[model samples]
Target chain A: MKKFIEKIIQGLFTVSGFVTSIAILLIVLFLFTEGMGLFKNKLVEDGYQLVVNKQNDVSSLSAEQIKDIFDGEITNWNEIGGRNQEIILFRLNDISNYFTDEELGSELEFVPEKISELIAQHPEMIGFIPQQYIDNAFKGKVLEAGKIGFSDIFLGKEWIPTATPVSFYGILPLVTGTLWVSLVAILLALPFGLAAAIYLAEMANHKMRNILKPLIELLSGIPSVVYGFFGLIVIVPLVQKLFHLPVGETGLTGSIVLAIMALPTIITVSEDAMRNCPRSMREASLALGGSKWQTIYKIVIPYSISGITSAVVLGIGRAVGETMAVLMVTGNSAVIATSILQPLRTIPATIAAELGEAPDGGVHYQALFLLGIILFVITQIINSSVEYVSAKNKI
Target chain B: MNITLKKRRSQHLAFGIVSLLTYSIVAILIIILAFIIIRGIGVINWEFLSTAPTDGMTGGGIFPAIVGTCYLILGSAAFAFPVGIMSGIYMNEYAPKGKLVRFIRMMTNNLSGIPSIVFGLFGMALFVNKLSFGDSILAGSLTLALLSLPLVIRTTEEALKAIPYSFREGSYALGATKLQTIRRVTLPMALPNITTGLILAVGRVSGETAPILFTCAAYFLPQLPSGVLDQCMALPYHLYVLATSGTNMELQRPIAYGTALVLIMIVLLVNITATVVRRYFANKVKMN
Candidate 1:
């Protein structure tokens, strides 16, 4: 009976472990299913295509160029590396401009055929209409609609996700903004965090260490939204006054908030590492006439460099993944950050701010998911590398 | 002798600077806590604690948000505790030390590192859209459960590791089976630590704004939630809306402070409870 019960318990354990592992798999699968589905979307709206005269040398057009042509920003074919001719834009609704309603008839039943004929007449003419309107047997050249490309998604500078004709899904600005805030945050946080960690681990008396330790843990436990509120009420105004800027909200404010938020992580991890340094090393350094500060700087730090490295890496991971505080304090300007004082939007902020309203399965929604994938991969890399360093150093 | 004097002066300076840095961290924490508490204490009252909002959330109290957060905590704990404890038990007791265990550990770490907002996205996709649960409490709880699972597993495993093998040996030598030994010996020894982990998980689930932002947070619902399916106001999300997009920002500023204060108190309470549990267990062990 005991053996049977043990078997049942073993089976339960295996099943639970298997189920726990499956959860992570499901999250990644769901993210990719929605994110990669963006690529399968047609550049043009469904049931519509762009057609030009067959003689036109341009066999394909980028979404941006098409938008430009339609918006009348680029009126000449020569501007797009094509023949030296003025481009004529046509929409199905613009048929009356070319042919009178009386001439084309009120029903406009043949408007599709006439639009195709109109396209054939002018080499520079680009017409957008129902895909069924274009007769394949006719001479109109149908522009091969391209799927959303890697360059368009990753390298594109504009993030206008609701642009007419096509939404721009470029993530350059958001990605750079995220990096800038996190970079500044880490830079500001590291020295102070290290100093505090060293003091707590090596210099502080038992009473001081006991008091300060729980305070730091409590700081870490404070909800990020509270930190964000603090940033709004305190840091934002402080930056504005200190820098004499027109607005308080900037990447600098976000960075400062993130720095504060990341401090507890860095200090805790690095201090633990410092404490873990064998007592004999510290005794020997002191016996050699090294001051406490000198001993910590030389012996304790060197002995646990990997642990400190992991601490900083984990701190960076926290800063990068942080959304709410950064979202609240950063001006939410979706522009590439020119300076720390300027307003910027991080990827996490963008997703948090925009995903609520974006229609499901829309380009905007999918782009947010893609941003999530990027964030997931970036943080996963940072964390696993930390894990690897710590694991490697374990022996 | 002059160089040695200069080195001594520099050492004193370094010591002063490091102490100053540590004090500054403490100062920052105090300033934040003091500011919130001073501004927020006045706003906490019976009416504020019991009543729902009125006049565009600028009047009345944050009762619904408080209840919603409690519901969310209860829901997530209900879902995560059993699964996480079970998985932790497996990893500690039954699982062999091998590549598979390593992979599971790596994945658990990875899960913890994934941004809470990304979890929001996943929750929105899987629970809200795919699972057709809509923006409901059940969906939010499931997402939060996933969020805290890694934390639970790691803590559970740590607690289990702290139990000596000799205890298990003694139980087995008494003719107890593996299951009985674990049930009768290991789990009791580990319960205090497991409770600490649960308290910590509560702190996490309550404080998290990003994951619940999409999954269940309502913009402004004054009444208490009637069912799991109904959207409900939560403390973090309520604070977010009041600060960012609510109709009258300045008017709601004090209320937002109160909400922040409440959130901080709850999280701090959970943290303190966990610490107390840990200390109690440590003392118990010492006494033994």
Candidate 2:
């Protein structure tokens, strides 16, 4: 009877790990199932069209042509599009007059300035609006969903993804915005977090390490919304007034907020890995007359490459995945930017900002899920790469 | 190389500076704790504990939120502890350094890194939509359970690994079978650690918001959680509402701070008790 019970216990244990692995697989599968619908229509995968210049048969239009192709009244001689004569560029506005919701920053704002610029320089240039703006009046002519499928939102300059079934779910602004914030966050966090970790693991005395350790761990337990609150009250206005910018809610401020939040995790994990590094190795390095810093850099760090990198990568992951803080501080502007100070959107922030009111399984919903998938993939790449490098170093 | 007075002074400076970081951490903790206690304590009269919340946070105590907090934690413990502990047992004892075991190890680590909101999304999709467990405490607890499991597994695995092998061999030497030895000897030895892990797990689920936001959290609640399937008001969600804001910004902020204070206290108490028990046993071990 005892032997039988022993066998039963062993059997149960064998199966438990298998069950846990299956749970993770199910999560990945569910994400893909929810998001695979966006790729089905297949009109365009992820590219912009050249608008097929009829006169010159130019396969690709110049940058000016791309610009003129967006302005409404660029319709005359030498009007951009690579020195072409007498061009008639078609815009969605020329096709239909469906302009509403002035609060949404209507196409009219960009249309006027661009139209004058096109008219002044080259009369024959035309601009391209979204296929949604192209509507029924413009259908069966030159532009439609037939020419550009749903994914063109990522391809274009516009930032709107919440327009749903009617408008393009342009993720370009939000994606770039998120990338910019997280990128800056990683830059700020990586060095400080690493140095702190190094100090705790290789240098600090036991009592000091104990006190610092739990405090850092406790920081993660602090709710992220509080961090959001802090950013709004403190960081946002301070930066705003300090720089005298239009608003303090820019990507740089968001990065700082997130960096503070991420410091705990990066410090804790990296310190643990470094602390676990063999004492013998360090002693040997010192026996060879190496200084403390030299021992740490040459001996300890060399043995712990994977841990430090994993620490940095995980910090980057936190920056990428963080939502509420990013949403509250990044001004929610869905625009691509070159400067760290500019307001921007991130994929996670875009999804969080709009997911609550987003109509379920609508174009906006699908688009948000698509962004989630992108975020998921980027983290997976980071996670798997860390695991791979760690394993490689071990062998 | 010759030792210089400057080198010694600089080394002293480095030690002073590095250790100074500990002061800042402790200071931050004290400031945050004091802010919570002051705000949370003033309004936390006996009536506040006994009464229920009413319209616009004017005359509401956090009775339901506290009870709901308790019920939610109990449910999450129920949901997570059995499976997580079992998985740990399997990893430590049965699966021994094979490819499958290695894969399981990696998955456990990866599981912890997943963002809480993504877990919220998964719960929203799976529980609210697929299982039809819409906005219920059971739904919330199960999601919290999933979130807590990785920690439980890691903690329990370490706990189990700490047991010396001599106890196992002695039981087996008495002609006791493997199952008998583990149950009679190994399990009793690991019980304290198991409780330690459970305490930590409880602390984790109590404070979590994102997953519960998607699965359960109602904006306003005047009642208590009556059953497993019932919708409930949770402390974290209430705090989330109060802090980030809703219609009642002025009324809710103090209550939110009070709730946060209550949360931090509960977690601190649990951790301290566990540490004391651990120290007691360690002392006993040393005396022997």
Candidate 3:
């Protein structure tokens, strides 16, 4: 009976271990399955179609070209393999711009007729109208808006995910914004973190180390939302005042906050690495007439280089994955940031801010999931590399 | 002599720089703590701590959010501790050292490193939508349980590993079963460290906002959650909403500070308790 009970307990333990492995699999499965639903969606808004005069030669437009045309970047039809004429943009709202309220009749009863008539009158015009408006008597040809392609997301430039006629799911701005903030954060954190690690590991007395180490751990334990609140109340105003900027919620503020957050991880990890250096090596350096700094810079640091590298990598991981603080401080703008002073949006921040409002199983919702996949992939690579480096260090 | 003098000067400079940088970090921490305490103390009266929020969260207290965070912490701990402790025991005591073990360890590490927001998305997908729990405390707790599971397992394994092998061997020599040996000897010795890990997990679960933002967190629920299926406000999420997307930013600013202070205090309190428990236990073990 005891043996049987032991077997049962062992089975429970084995099953529990498998639970973690299965969880990782499930996260990947759900993220990809939901995210890949984006491709099945059309580039044009649902329930809407692009219509042009039958005389026009332009038959269809790729998602990119349509976005470019609507954004006013591509004004000539010739640019997109169409007839050599200026492209005229039209939307449902543009009907009111061309016609008076009286002309459209009460309750806009003549909107469909007037829209078809307007499209027929101008060969260069492309109208984005409701599918219901394009009936059998419509004088224009319907243009097929192709489904969203992979390049429209990975390599595309714009990230306006809720634009009318078509929402841009281009990830360039978000990717670059995330990279910029993380890069600056690492740049700011590395010197300070390394210095602190060196001091605590080699220089500080036991008492000082005890107090300071726990203090730093306490720093890490503080919730990120608190850091964000601190940033919003204090750093934002300070940055604005110093730079004379219109708003303080720039990439720099986010970098500063992330740097602060990353400090404890970097310091703790690197300090442990440095402390692991053999005492005999330091003694030999000092016995050979080497200075304290020389012994550290030459022997201890080189010996623990892999550990320090893994520490920095972990710091980078933290900075990249942080959501709440970045969302709170970084002025959530979905533009490709050219400078640190400019406001930009990060992938995690964008997800956190937008996922609440995105309808379930919709294209916008799928796009956010795709962003999650990108983040998951990036962090997985970082984590696996950290694992590899530390594994190598152990060997 | 000249080279030696130059080396000494450079060493002094390097030491000065590192010491300055280290203290500056501590100083910054102090400034942050001080700033919050100074600004938030006025709003920390009995009314603020005990009453429900009023006037669209501009007046009254943050009692509901505090209670919600407490529920989440308890729920996550309940789900995570048994699985985590058992997994740690399995790895340390039962599982043979092999490639499979290495693979499981890698997966655990990767899971922990996955962004909290990704966990939020996963929680929304699995617990909220797929499982049809719909935004509720149960879903949020399960999500947080996943997030903290890796930490708990890692710490528990370390705690178990710290116990000397002789105790287990002695139990076995006395004709005890493997489970009995572990239950009576190793687990009791490891309990204090495991408790520390549990406290730290509570600290983490309390402060998490992204994972609960969609799974369970309500912008402002007038009443406390009476069931696991109900939505509730959490301190971190409440602070985020008030700071970023509140009805009145000006009125909510002070309250946001108060909320932040409360959050920091709870996390710090939990951390201090963990540290004290570990220290006291370490000394006790040494004395024995």
Poorest 10 consecutive residues of model 1 chain A by lDDT?
A130-139
In model 3, the clashing pairs are none
**How well does candidate 3 match the true structure in TM-score terms?**
0.95
Runs of candidate 3 exceeding 4 Å displacement: A68-90, A93-124, A132-139
Q: How well does each candidate reproduce the native contacts, as fnat?
A: 0.72, 0.21, 0.79
Ranking by lDDT: 3, 1, 2
Across residues A21-52, which tens digit of lDDT does each residue of candidate 1 receive?
68778888999999988888777765688888
Residue-wise lDDT of candidate 2 within A174-198, one digit each (tens)?
A: 7778778887887887766777787
lDDT score at residue A370, model 3, on the 0-100 scale: 99
- Model 2: residues >4 Å from true position, as ranges? A1-12, A41-144, A147-159, A245-248, A284-294, A297-303, B1-6, B9-13, B20-26, B49-52, B57-59
Judged by TM-score, which candidate is best? 3
lDDT of 3 by residue, B165-256 (tens): 99898999999989998898899999999999999999999999999988999988878899999998899999998888867889998898
Alpha-carbon interface RMSD for all candidates, in angstroms: 1.3, 2.7, 0.7
Q: Return the TM-scores of chain A for each candidate in numbered order.
A: 0.89, 0.71, 0.90
TM-score, model 1 to reference: 0.94
State residue B11's C-alpha deviation in candidate 3, in Å.
Answer: 1.7
